[model samples]
Target: MALLYQFFTALWELTGAMAPYILFGLFFAGILHEWLPENFIRKHLGGDTIFSVLKSTLFGIPLPVCSCGVIPLAASLKKEGASRGSVLSFLISTPITGIDSILATFGMFGWIFTIYRVVTSIVIAFIAGIVSNIVGERGDKDPAGSSASPIRPASFRADPPAPGQAGGACGCDGGCGAEAERGFSFFEAMRYGFVTLMGDIAKPLFWGLLIGAAITVAIPENIGEWLSGYTWLGYLLVIAIAVPMYVCATASLPIAASLVLSGVSLGAAFVFLSAGPATNTVTIGVVRKMLGSRSLIVYLATIVGGSLLFGLGLDLFFDTMQIDPRSVVHMEEHGGWATLLASVILWGLMLRFLLPPLFRRKRRCEGEEDSCCTKG
Candidate 1:
C-alpha cells in the first residue's frame, strides 16, 4: 500500500512538472503549423547537397513529431523530391529532439543535459545524412524501382488545403494550409495545440508515465550501485531495451529520470534516450521502404554507433567532472499551480479525444448489431 502511494505520488509529480512545458511546446508547434509556408520545407530540402541535409536537420529539430508521425511526412518529402540524405536527417533528428521533448528534458533534468541531448541528436543526424548520401543512389528511383519526378514549384501556394484533405505530417491533422484557410484564428491554434497535439501524444505519454512509475517501484534503490560496477553492460542493456521500443522523446524523459533515480548511469540513460525514441522496428521497415537497403543500413549504423560513442563520452565527462546524475534530477524545477492547471487541462483533452470516441463506438455497436465495430 505504501509502495502504491509512493508510485502515484511520483507519477503526479512527474506529470505536473512536464505539463506546462508540453502545453507551451504544443502552442509553438501550432503557430509553426499555421505560419510556415506550405512549400517551405519542400522548397528548401530537395537538393543533393550537404546544405540540404543541414537544413533538414535544423528544420526537424524544433518540430513536434514522433517516429510514427514522421513516416508519412518523410514520405511526402520523398514524393516532393527531397534527397534521401535530407529525408534521413529529418527522420533522425525530428523524433529524437523536439521543442516539447527539449522543454520536458529541462524540466526533468537540467540545462546541461538538455543541451547535450539536442547537440548529440543533431550530430548523429548529420552523420546519418552524410553516410546515406555517400551510400544511397542519386537517381529518381523509388525503393520499389518506380520512377519519380521532382515536384518543385516555381511559387508557393497561398491557400490552404480544403477540408478533409490531409496536411503535412508534422503531427498536425489539417496540415499547414488547414489553419491558413481558417484565417489562423486563436481558437484554431488552441484546438490544434491542446486537442490535436494532445491526442497525438496522450497514449505514449500515458504509457511512459505508467512505466516510469513502475520502474520506480520495481527497481531496488541500490540497483544503480550494483550496476555501476558493470558500466558497459549497463549501456548495452539499455540499448537493447531502447532500440526497438516506440517511446516518444518527451515521454521517455520521465522514464530516464526514474532510471537515474534508481542509480542507472547517466550514460546508460542517455543511450536509452538517444535510441529509444528515434529507432524502432516500424521505423526501420519504413526507412527500408522509403530509401534503399543501403540508406537503411547507414541510418541504423549511425544511430547505434553514435549513441554508444556519445554515451561513453558522457560517462567519461561525468566521471572526470565529478557531476552527479542524481543532483541533476534533484535540480529539476518544481511546478506550482500553473503546472497543476496544465495537467488537468491535458488530462481532460486526452479523455475527450482518446476515450469518448471508443465509448461512443461501443454504444453504437450495442444499438446496431451490424455495425462495423461489432463486426470487428
Candidate 2:
C-alpha cells in the first residue's frame, strides 16, 4: 500500500540518524532500572504536596527519557508506590528533554537555547507537579483508582539493593523463583531496554513516519503560512496541534527549527518545540490517574500557560536584545556524507541491538555472564 510504504520510509528516516544515541539511552535507562529502588521513590515521593512535586521534578530532570519511553516507566514508578505528584512530575519532565535529546538539541540549537530548554523544562515540571498536588486528594485516599500502574518487580526501592541482590526483583505478586536468579547483565539489560523501547514505540514510529513523510514529500510548502501574520495565535495553534501528536522530543526539534526558518514566529516554534512531544494523550491519561482530576487540570494548565508565557517572553527577549536566531539550516548545500554517516551509525546500532540475542546464548553457555546486563 502507498500508505504502508510511506510509513516505512518515514520510520527509516526518523530512526535513521539518531538510532545509536537512542540505543545507548535505553542501555542507561535499564541500568538505572536495575540500580534504583521503588521504595525510595515511594517514601520520598509519596505525598500530594509541593515538596513531593519538587522532588519528582528534580529527580526527573537529568534522566534521559523521551516521550515514547517515559509512559511505561512513569506508570511503573506509580505502581511501585510512587506518589501521584511524583508520577505527575515524571510525566511532565520526561518528554521535554533527556540526555540524548540534550545532545541532539545542542547540536541543532546551540548551547544557549539548549540550556534554556533544560532549565525551563525543569522549572515548568516542578510548578506543574506542585499545582497538581495542591489541587488533588490527600495521600490517605484511594491512590490507585481506575488507572492501572506499571508492573513492578516487588523488590523495587529508592536505595540500590546490596551488590549481589537484584533491585525490585519481586514480580508484581512478590513471589521469588529461579527465573529471578537469572539476573540480567548490563549488556543483556541494554538489549532488553532496546527491545522494550522498540516494542513500546514501534507503533507510534510507524504512524509518525507515515505522517512525516507525507509532510516532507507532499506538503513541501510552508504549512504555517496562514498564521504567519498572527504570531500569538499561531503559537497557541502549535500547542493544540502538538498535544495529541506522538513525535519524539528530539525528532520534533528539526521540524521546529524548520518552522522557525520559514518565517514562523519564534513563539510558535517554541510552542511546537515544547508541546509536540510532551502533552500527548498517553501522558494525559497518565496525568489524570496519577495527579487526580484536579491535578490533571492544573498540569494541563501549567503546560499550556507556561509554554505561552515562555514563548512570549522569548519573543520579547529576542526583539529587545536584538538577538537574531541563526538559521536552522547550515550550508546552502546539503550534507550528503554527514547524512550517510549518521544513517549508517544509527542503523548499525539498531541492527546490533536487534540481532545479538540470536548469538548471545553461546556466550552465556560459555559461562560468560555479561556484567552489562541489568538485573531489574
Candidate 3:
C-alpha cells in the first residue's frame, strides 16, 4: 500500500515537472507550421546530394512533429517531388527533438547527454540523406529530364487575397491577409502567435503528462536495475520495443529518467532517447511507399546504426570515466521541498497554455449557435 502511494506521488510530481514546457513548445511549433510554406521548402531543398541533405536537416530540426507525424510530412514531401535523398534526411531528423524535447531532455538527462542527443540527430540525418543519394538506385525515369519544370516556377507569385477576405489576425500569414489590407500591426501578430500556439499544443501536453504519470506508477524499480547489468541487451530491448511503439521525444524523457533512476543502464536510456523518435511503424511504412524499398532500408540503417554506436560510446564513457550513476537521480530526500515547489509552478504554467484555447473554442461554438437561432 505504501509502495502504491509512493508510486502515485512520484508520478504526479513528474507530470508537473514536464507539462508546462511541452505546452509552450507546441505553440512555437504551430507558429512555425503556419509561417513555413511548402513551396519554399520544396524550391530550395530538392536536388543533388549534399545541398538536399543539409536543407532537409535544417528544415526538420525545429518542427514539432513526432515519430507518428513524420510519416505524413515525409510522404507529402515525396509527393511534392522532394528528392528521395532529402526526404530520407528529413525522416531521420524530424522525430529527434525540438525546443520542447530538448528542454525535457535537459530536465531528465542533464546538459551533456542532451548535447550528445541533438548533435547525433543532426549527423544521422545528414549521413542518411547523403548515403541514400549515393547508394540507392534512382527508381523512376524523368520524362522531362533537365527540362522538367521545378515544382515552383521562379516567376510565380502566390495568389492575391479577395477583397474583405481579411487576413487572419494571427500575423502568421505575413500581413498577406485581409488585416494587412486594412492595417498591419505587430501586436496582433504576437497575439495570434500566442493563441495559435495554445490551440495546437494543448492535446499533446495533456497526453504526455498522463503517459508520464502512468509509467511512473506502473513500472517497478527492480526491472530497471536488473536490466542495467546487461547493458547491450538493454539497448537491444529498447530498440526492439521502441521501434514498434510510437513516442515523441519530449514525452519519452521523463520515463527514461525514471528508468535510469530505477537502475536501467544509461546506455539503454540513450537508445530509447534516440530510437524512440527515429524509427516507428508509421514512419517506416511512409518511407517504404513514398521513397521506395531501398530508401526505407537506408533510413532504418541510419537510425539503428547511429543509435547503437552512440549507445556503445555512452556505455564506454560511463564505465571508463567512472561517472556515478546515482548522481543523476534526484529523489525526494535531497531538496524535496524545492523540487516540489518548482514542479507546481511548472504545472500551473502548463495549465495556462492549455486551458485558454479550450475556452475560446467553446465560446466560438456558442456564438455560432446563437447566430443560427436568431436567423431561424
Candidate 4:
C-alpha cells in the first residue's frame, strides 16, 4: 500500500510538471499539420540523393508522431515516390523527439540537454539515410531515371495498419489519410491537437506515467552516484530495455527523470530517451516488412550505435565542463495551483479517451455486442 501510494504521488507530480508543455506541444503539432502543404514532404523526399534524406530528416524532426504513428506515413512515402533511404531517414528522425517531447524535456531537464537531443537526432538520422543509400538497395528508381525516388521504394510488402488499429488510432494522424486542405483553421487545429492527436497518445501517456512512477518507487535516489563511472553499464541496460519497448516522446520524459533520480547519469538516461522512442519490437517488424531484412539490420545498428555514441559525448561534455546534469534539472515546476489545474485537466482528457473502449469491451464481453456496444 505504501509503495502504491508512493507510485501515485510520483505519477501526479510528474504529470503536473509535464502536462502544460504537452498541451502546448500538441497544439503546435496541429499547427504544423495544418500549415504545411500535405504533400510538401512527399514532394521533396522522392529523390534518391543525400538531399532527399536531409529533407526527410529535417521535416520529421518537429512533427509530433510516435514510433508507432510513423509507420503508415513512412509506408506512404515508400509507396508514393520516396526512396528507401528517405523512408528510412524519416523513420529514424521522427519519434526520437517531437515538439511536445522537446518542451517536456526542457521543463524537466534544461535547454542544453534539449539542444543536444535535437542535434543528435539530426546527425543520427542523416547518417542512417546516407548509409542506407550507399549499401542498401535502391528498391525503385526515381525521377532521376524518369521515375520518382531512389530514397523511395517502388513497392513495400506489407500494408499499413487499418484505421482502427493501434498505429492508425488517431486516423493515422499524418500517415494513412489523404491530404487535408492546406488552408488553416484555428478550430481544426485545436480539434486535431486536443482531440485527434491527443486521443491517439492518451492511453500510452497514462501507461507511461504509471511505468515512470513505478521506476521511481523501484530505484533508490542518488544510486547514480555509485554507478557514475560505469556509464557503459547504464547504456547497455537502457538499450536492452528501450529497443523492445514503445514509449512516446512526451511519455518518455518522466521515465527518464526516474532514471536521473536513481543516479543514472544524464548521458545514460539520454540513451533511453533516444533509443526508446525510435526503436521498438513492433517497429522492428514494420521496418523489416517495409525495407527488407538488410535495411532492417542497418536501421537497428544505426539507432543503437548512434544512441551509444551520442550518449557518451553528452556525458563527456558535462564532465569536461565540471557540470552535473542533475544539477540543471528543473522538476520544481510542480506543486503550483497552475500545475495542479493542468494535471487535473490532463487527467480529464486522458480519461475521456481511455474509458470508452474499456466500457465497450465490457459490454461486448457480457454478450451485449448487438446493443450499444456496436456503436463503440
Candidate 5:
C-alpha cells in the first residue's frame, strides 16, 4: 500500500512537471505544421552533399514525431528524392530530441543535461548521415534501372498516414497549401495542436508514465550503488532495453527520471534517453529495407557507439564538477499552480483521445445488429 502511494505520487509529480511545457510544445508543433510545406523538406534533402545532411539533422531536431511515427515520413522523403544520408540523419535526429522533449528534459533533468542531449543527438545523427553517404547504396533504384517505390513493405504500408496528410473528412491535415485553398483559420491550428497531436501521443505517454512509476516503486535505492562499479555494464543494459522499445521523446522523460532517482548513473540515464525513442525493432526493419543493409549498419553503429561515448563523457564531466544527481532532481520539483492546471488539461485531452465515446460505440453496434446482438 505504501509502495502504491509512492508510485502515484511520483507519477503525478512527473506529469505536473511535464504538462505545461508539453502544451507549449504542442502549440509550437502545430504552428510548424501549418507553416512548413512538405515540399520544403523534399527540396532541401534531395542532394547527397554534406549540406543536405546537416540540413536534415537540424530540421529533424525540433520535430515531435516518435520512432514509429517517423518511419512513414522518412519513407516519403526517400520516395520524394531525399538522399540516403539525409534520410538517415532525419531518422536519427527527429525521434531522439524534439521541442517538446527538450522542454520536458529541462523540466525533469536540468539545462545542462538538456543541452548535452540535444548536442549529442545532432552529432550522432550527423556522423551517421556522413557514414551512410559514403557506404549506402546510391539512389532509390533497382538493379534493373527502374525507380524503386516506397521502401516500406506492402504489409507495413497500411500504418497511419504521415501526420500532416489527408486521412479523413476533417481536412485536419496541416498542409499549408491545403489550408490556404480552404482558407486557413486559427481554430484549425488549435485543433491540430489539441486534437491531432494530442491524440497521437496520448497512449504512448500514458504507458511511459505507468512504467516510470513502476520502476520507481520496484527498484531499490541501493541498486544505484550496486551498479556504480559497473558503469559500462549499466550503459550497455540501458541501450539494450531502450533500442527495441517504442517510447516517444516526450514519453521517455519520466522513465529516465525515475531510473536516475533509483540510483542509476546519469550516463546510463542518458543512454536510455537517446536510444529509446530513436530506435525500435520496427524502425530497424524499416531502415534496413529503405537504405539497404550497409546503411542500416551505419545507422545502428552510430547510435550505439555515439551514445556510449556521450554517456561516458557526461559521467566524467559530472565527476570532475562534483555534481549531484539528487540536487538536479530537487531543482526540477518547483512546479506550482500552472503545472497543476496544465496537468488537469492534459489528462482531460488524453482521456478524450484514449477512450471511445459511448454514443459512437452504441451507433456502431446498432449498425451491426447481427454481430453485436450475437456477442451480447
Candidate 6:
C-alpha cells in the first residue's frame, strides 16, 4: 500500500512539473501547423546540394512529428523530388526534438540540457544529411554523377498517384495527413494542438508517466553513483533499447528524467532522449524502401554513431566543467495551483481520448462482432 502511494505520488509530481509547458508547447505546435506555408518545405528542399541538406535539417527542427509520423512525410519528400540527403535529413531531425518537445525538455531538464539536445540533434542531422549526399554522389549516382543512377529502383523515382490513387507500396505515408480542405481558424489551430496532437500522444504519454513513476519508486537511490564509471555501458544499453523503440519525443522525457533521478548518468538519459524518438523498426523499413540500401546504412550509422559520440561529449563536458547534473534537473514535486490545474487538465484530456477507444475494444471483446455489444 505504501509502495502504491509512493508510485502515484511520483507520477503526479512528474505530471505537475510537465503539464503547463506541454500545454503551452501544444498551442505553439498548432500555430506552427497552421501558419507555416504548406509548400515551404517542398519548395526549398528539391536540389542535390549542400544547402538543400542544410535547409531540410533546419526545417525539421520545429516539426512535431515522431519517428513513425516523419517516415511518410520523408517519403513524400522523396516522391516530390527532394534529394536523398534532404529526405534523410528531415527523417533524422524531425523526430528527436520539436517545439512541443523543446518546451517539455526545458521544463523538466533545465535550459542547459534543452539547449544541448537541440544543438546536438541539429548537428547530427546535418552531418547525416551531408554524408548521405556524399554517398549518393559516389555510390548511388549516374556514371556522369549528374543525377541518380538507372540502377536505382523504379519505385524510388516515381511520383505518387493523384488523389484516390492507392496502387503502390511507394509513398505509402504520403497521404497520412491529407485532411479535407477547410478555412483556417485560430480555434481550429488550437483544436489540432489540443485535440488532434494530444490524442496522438496521450497513450504514449500515459505509459511514459506510469513507467517513470514506477522506476522512481522501484530503483535504489544513488545507483548512478556506483554506475558512473561504466557510462559507456549505460550509453550502449540506452541505445540498444531506444533505437528500436517507438516512443515519441514528448513521451520520452519523464522516463529519461526518472532514470536520472534513479542514479543513471545524465549522458545515458540524453542517449535515450536523442535516439529513441528518431529511430524505430517501421522507420527503418521505410528508409530502405524510399531511399535505398546504401542510404539506409548511412541513416542508421549516422544516428547510432553520432548519438553515442554526442552522449559521451556531454558527459565529458559535465565532468570537465564540474557541472552537477542533478542541480539542473527540474523535477518539481511541489508546484503552485497553476501546475496542479494543468496536471488535472492534461490528465482529463488524455483520458478523454484514450478511454473511449479502449472502452469500445473492451465491449467488442465481450461479445461477437455481429452482436449488440459490438454495436456503436
For model 1, the stretches where C-alpha displacement exceeds 4 angstroms are: 138-141, 145-183, 330-335, 358-376
The predictions' CA RMSDs to the true structure, in order, are 6.3, 6.9, 7.4, 7.3, 6.7, 7.3
Candidate 3 shows a clash count of 5
User: What is the per-residue lDDT of model 3 for residues 197-248, given as tens digits with 9 covering 90 to 100?
Assistant: 3333345445655665566667786875667566678888888977776767
Taking all chains together, each candidate's TM-score versus the true structure is: 0.85, 0.71, 0.73, 0.83, 0.85, 0.84
Prediction 6 global C-alpha lDDT: 0.77
Range of the 10 consecutive residues with the lowest summed lDDT in candidate 6 = 366-375
- Residue 91's lDDT within candidate 1 is 94
lDDT (Cα, tens digit) per residue for candidate 1, span 1-376: 9988988988887788777778788888767655666667878999879999999999989876677768767876887788899999999999998877888888778789899999999999998998788778765356862134222211122232345553332113324222243355666555556655666677888889888888878899889889988888998888899888898898898899889888999888999999999999998888887898888888988998999999899889998999887788742445667777988876665566557656334333222122112111
- Give the alpha-carbon lDDT of every model: 0.76, 0.60, 0.63, 0.76, 0.76, 0.77
Candidate 2 positional error at 226, Å: 6.1
lDDT of 2: 0.60
lDDT of 2 by residue, 1-376 (tens): 8866854564455444344445555566657655554344556766566777788787676554567556666766665566666777778777787655666565556677778777778878888776655556555354464356354322222222334555323322343211233343676445445554444434443444345445544543564466545777777678879888778775676566555555566766777777777798877876666546777787788888888888787777776987654353221322367655665655554444445565233332112122212222
Worst 10 residues of 5 by lDDT: 367-376
**Best candidate, lDDT-wise?**
6
* Model 5 agreement with the true structure over 126-182: per-residue lDDT tens digits: 999999998786663422211343322111112222455543211233421121223
Q: Report residue 245 deviation for candidate 2 (angstroms).
A: 1.7
Q: Which digits, one per residue and each the tens of the lDDT, describe model 6 over residues 160-253?
A: 3355765222223454323334465797568668866776688899999998999899989868876886777889889999999989999999
For model 2, the run of ten residues with the poorest summed lDDT = 364-373
Which portions of model 5 miss their true places by more than 4 Å?
138-184, 330-335, 358-376
How accurate locally is residue 47 in candidate 1, as Cα lDDT from 0 to 100? 80
